[model samples]
Target: MRKERKMDVDDEQVQVMDLEAQQKKTSESDLPKIQKKAKHPVILKFKDVVYKVKFPSQRKKFFKQTTSSPVRERVILNSISGVVYPGEMLAMLGPSGSGKTTLLTALGGRLGGNLKGSITYDGKPFSNQMKRNTGFVTQDDVLHAHLTVTETLVYTALLRLPNTFTKEQKIGVAEEVIIQMGLTRCKNSIIGGPLLRGVSGGERKRVSIAQEMLIDPSLLFLDEPTSGLDSTTAQRIVSVLWELAQGGRTVVMTIHQPSSRLFYMFHKVLLLSEGNSLYFGSGSHVMDYFESVGYVPSVPMNPADFLLDLANGVSPDESEDIVTVKEKLIVAYKNNIANELKADLREEENEEADHRKEANTEIEKWPTTWWQQYTVLLKRGLRERKHESFNILKIAQVLIVAFIVGLLWWQSKITHLQDQVGLLYFSTGFWGFFPLFDAIFAFPPERMVLAKERSSGMYRLSSYFFARMVSDLPVELILPTVYVIITYFMGGLKRNAASFLYYLFSLLLSIMVSQGLGLALGALVMDLKAATTLGSVLMLTFLLAGGFYVQNIPAFIKWIKYLSILNYNFKLLLGSQFKPGDTYPCDGDTKVCLVEDFPSVRSVGIRGQFVSAIVLVIMFVGYRLIAYFALTRIGVTRKSRTTKSWLLCLD
Candidate 1:
């Protein structure tokens, strides 16, 4: 028994010693024996990308807006070689001056550049359809500020989803993203306004996330996720991204000044300082590399921040060795045997993406016929186009101008022909034509919104063109109604009110025709200054050639009078109210007073409302069509229809 006890004691001591040895080994290994290097996980191949973006450079002169400037030397991204794997999250990190945003923008196909490299999805080259599966959320939240959280998500779902995703599917998709992103609390709140009125910044960020996720993108790229948010909020945003990465979707984010919370959210970190890479792989391995050098990372600190401080240099002036050290670190991370393997793997993935894309039959992803889709898009555009201030200002000007002019005419004595002719100048040629301002000021604002929405696939120029015509009818009619009624009542020197009413209608038609022409002028000249100048020129031309001031012009210029919408309408108006032999020439004794009607050429032509209305209304229609065709062909973009097409399928 004593011998057995001694043996048991010896065995127990052996076990304890073994345990201690293992612990010692772990402690030493965790600290790194020599310099430590990180390893790259296998990269997953994405499908192809087709990114063609045009980035407008600041021109030396404004003339570049009208006359084309040299197409910028486009950056080519024909094929991006890096293949981020399914289980991994790759961060594009760079120095402040480095082209991180530029790269992101190029990758997303938002910026037009020289794209030489072919970016493959799996193994196949990129196609339009392949790109549809990828979601890119820009740094700024591109959302309608007026919409509530639910409204936004629902809208996105409606627009982006396929027809196959039924109402339940949409609701389910939105709800899932909301839960995953921690947006449950403020899902009902408005997007933005006074801080008190809407969702918090964090919530808005999630809403953006939910919007992108509406299509269930396989690869999601977020450009500078932490740009405008507070540290805590930024961290929260990162956490949601981590949650997404865990769900098997690859996430690539360009992050700046990440809080420790954000750092912890990342499973891997690719540290880029300047255009060169500093480190890649597990974030936990970062401290060991620095420790090998003389720099010791402090505790309770953000390692990313600590690393950047060292990488940028302690002061403006960096020692030669530190600069060399940063370069060497980057070279080791990106150029070593491990990196070679990662590169090879990425290439293979690219080839596979290409093969898959090329092999698959292309499906028509667009929702409906081109015309039908545009019709829907136009309706939406038209609704947005009807800004309230435009009509309000126009109607007020018309009523006030007509009333004052008529009152002045009523007060004046109609004693002689010259006096009546002078009054004709006061009524037609002299009255304020402020309604033309609508075309001048309005087109630019609508143009900006249209450009933006069109870029995103919001609507078509044709639909917007038609809607503008339809909506503007009320807008156009309002002024004419005011002008006609006010002038008819206020001007008491009426020969025959039925004839006077014809004059009012004719005047209304003339103004509307001018307004349409002005709108066309606005669309033609993109710049506000140029458009304004053109508008002034139009007004001058009409007033001069409109027969009030100038009785006769050259035969060639006389044709210009026919072209002058003002001339046709105004001519019919004056002719309509003429009463034959209602003459004034030399007064008394069978000698009529010198007068406009007493002239031999004073015989009336057409006086009916139908004549002027037909001419002016036809002119308006023709002008609108000209604007539509020009815009549809040149002014509007093809991308607008794409987004709308994507939206309709969701519905």
Candidate 2:
């Protein structure tokens, strides 16, 4: 009887185990399924993968090993290949710092750092047909808040969409995307990020999706689409992505910590650990493989979580299988695909070669020209800044400053030599340049916006640079005009009304010179804090170094005075104040001087005007070019093509 009871218990145990197995099989059968055909495969890729930079932390080490700072690069994917076919979604899910964003950026071919791998957009690298149909959404939402959702999309369509798309066609496309993303209710909402208040996080995420889809890209790459959202919202976001995939565009994204509902939406999952490709296959297989290797998901943990745990070596207990399971996946992937090696960096050399070869290729078949890009970007930039409250305050501040400056240096026939020198200094440097500084600082935030847009293909750099110059004309004239009217009326150095007007014109010219300098500065620096500090330092050096506060530096540094913006403004404008009979007996300081001994204006030399204007204009152009180059390099940084770009690579 005891033997029969033991046999019966054992039989019951086997029966219970078999019943649980059968239920799991039945449950899996009920889940939504994806076939291999639904999963996208790599079609085209960059041939020689090269990264001119690493993350900031890695740069110093890279330099230490390489003896060159920024040039120290790594080949991420030599003749590195990847593909994206139509009608499938390939999710490049990876651990943090596995170059997911870098890869996505490289594929976009817009504003990426140096890259060597030949990314075959549509059969060939940078094929006109492929570029026209591809869109990339970065981790950050790059949208103009001032423009409502509909307007932003409309503007994008106007700028990027083919001429075949009419106003009605554009609106139709925009409306479809709006409803598809569940933005029908807040269709006019602002896709706001930090410091902005508009649509909720979930809606904003979808808006980013809509913006990319509006262009009808053949392949879309999104980095961290579901970051910083709740499980339900994450699931909803992924579902939209899945639905988008159903429409036939190859969608790829880096997803982190997805819920179970979210996990199953992916057609294929590429698991990465420590920059190593661990698995590149199905999501269910992701869990099944782990289970087969001796790990099981506890009651409610999502598969994504369990996969990460295995990869990170999170043991369930003393006798647990997490370590062994993770190793099994890594080994299995490595064995199957056989891709475990350091990537060689070679983009720079290849780019130089490609530039030489493509030099005659008459800028790929694009709907717009570089000039058009600039114009649109410039118009948008103007819109961004023209609406800023700071600009209005600037007008008020200019009037107050002009009034105070006029009162302090009230035009006097009692012309002391120091008074003349002081007037020249104040007008050339302060009145002219301080407003420039204010105009620039006021526009810095807008510049931040421009950098984001320009980095993408929203507009051209030259357009933003030139448009700012044109837009600032009114802002530039405000203080100089006010000062000119006030000072001319005050009758400080009046030869005649004509002389006053001439001086006013010279002052306006001086202000313009300063304006150019400020715009250049706003574009050159990466961070606002750094740019602001540098601007302060530059302005101070220009003032003190321009023979304003101090007489002059030693003969060795007198050349610095020539570079000073104020020096030029002072000379040109002061020449106007010199009356006809003015001749100076030099105190051996010069062979002949116009104001050194003249009674009307006894200290400011007149010819300084001609020399200063020439120098200031030249310096203005020079500074503007520097600004452009800096902005371009920054765009490349965002794309992680530059070794310096790695600094921004986040975990």
Candidate 3:
């Protein structure tokens, strides 16, 4: 019996060894194939990068003092310098106000201002081609929440990948990225928002990274990739980055409070303090460098924590002044790492001059055509807006308002001039107000996603704007049609088919114009709360000038009525109901008064409200143009001899 048991144990041990061998073989086969370096391996180097902005003086309030001069110049980055080579995972660490993110944006060439610095890629000045080849992952995920993980990645791949790739190839890349990021299990799951239940935070973060990876960029920049993630999930993300670096792509990211294990995964570390670099060196050697300089950690602490403490001018014993310690570290870095960085850059330049010429000889255009962009974006927009566009609440709001108004003015007669005027005014005001508010939320919520995608050169501002406008029109017209259908017959106005059709057409045009105004307001304000407030105020002002409550205005302010959408819509609705030469019951001083005999446009000019309809169309196009410009001009800076607000106020 003992001999038989020994034989079984030996057999089990042999089986375990065989399994281990097979696992090793599988991992080896799965490894990314090593490829030769291209003529242009990107090596990013920035020197003396200084970024500054001017802000208004608090004493000179717009309502009070009225002086237009700015009193303060805030320096966001103070002569920062760094070198990032290919095949390196560089980690940037800093405290709350350390300018880490600012520097990253500057390096990615996304910031707008008077930048005084030298930033070179591949031993030459950075060009749009380099920008095209670079991938940037912003802190916010900036994804469409309703889209499934696979659908989101596939759409991004379509927009970003080169046109040379076939549709199947683009889809394959999306699938590969999903497998690589370990997201295949939930690829069909939706990326839910704050109010929705969907994927986990970690999965969403992975999807963000996956989208950027589809293009296979040479250099990637990420801002806070592991932010709002658990320690284990954060470590997993860093591990993937390490693998990417090993595959010969340059990865630079800003991290806050990374775990010790995650810290060790980085090949290099750049530490910043108040816009100053206190240390830029190898990650493994950072602790030793600090120790040699007489600043050793007394207890077992995270290397990330220790480095942040040193960067913030805190010593191990807490006895030294911050300024003194900061100065000491700055001087030490200058003496130790600065020269080494300079020497390495010089050597790379000497070796890669020929490669630079070959790599950047031609500028690359967008992979997809304008038409392709428009179609793809239009489809995606329609899909993304499916829930918001025709939701029950919005439809119900319009229906309930229309039903209430219809009941109140049940079968209103033209004999009662005041009641007819009130119905016309209320219809105009309600449709105008509802659609305008609906459009207000459209652009502000998607601004960040648009900004990020625009920075990546996915599509033109015109294509995106046009596609969004077109996709929304169909679904948006549904509720307005319902409102008009229910209200027009119930209120007993315009019983003839021709008049009813005219009224319905006028109402539809008004809703579209109101939505355009809302879109423009949203783009101009760029914040939901601010846009909503401004929209409400504008609606109230337009209501007052709508030619119903207060007629016979002074000539000076009569021109303001032209600016009111309510005025034109109300006129059209009134003109449709009271036709040319139509007579009303004789209750007034004048018996059998004709509709055209009223003292208004009926006898004066532009008969039948056709001109009003044309004007409404013009307003729709005009507001849409304003919205396009507002969206395109984002992140613009105007340097007049005047002060600018620190808040993101439109110029």
User: How close is every model to the real structure, measured as TM-score?
Assistant: 0.67, 0.77, 0.87
- Candidate No. with top lDDT: 3
Go through the candidates in order and give the C-alpha RMSD of each one to the true structure.
11.8, 8.6, 7.8
lDDT of 3 by residue, 1-651 (tens): 445535544654464466345333533454232232322458888877886767655663565766566558777677777788888989999887788887787788776565677677766665667766788988888899999999999999988888889989999989988887778889999999999988998888889988888878778899999999998778667766766776678889999899866776778899988777777878867776787778877765788999989888899999999999999988887888777765665545544677567656766667788998899899899888898888888778877888998898898877775676677778889888888988998888887788788878888888898899998897668777888888888787878898888788888889899999999999899899999999999999888877766667778988878888988898888777765667766565567876655544342222537777788899999999899999976433223322322221110
Candidate 3 to truth, TM: 0.87
Candidate 2 lDDT tens digits, 157-177? 656766677757877878776
Q: By TM-score, highest first, what's the ranking?
A: 3, 2, 1
Please report the TM-score between candidate 1 and the true structure: 0.67
How displaced is residue 204 in candidate 3, in Å?
Answer: 1.1
Question: What does candidate 1's lDDT look like per residue over 5-90, in tens digits?
Answer: 35544654464466346433532442112111111122244222232334345457654545565543222222233456655667
Off by over 4 Å in 3: 1-40, 56-71, 347-362, 413-418, 588-590, 596-608, 635-651
Please give the CA lDDT of all the candidate structures.
0.56, 0.61, 0.78
**How many residue pairs clash in each candidate at the backbone level?**
50, 30, 0
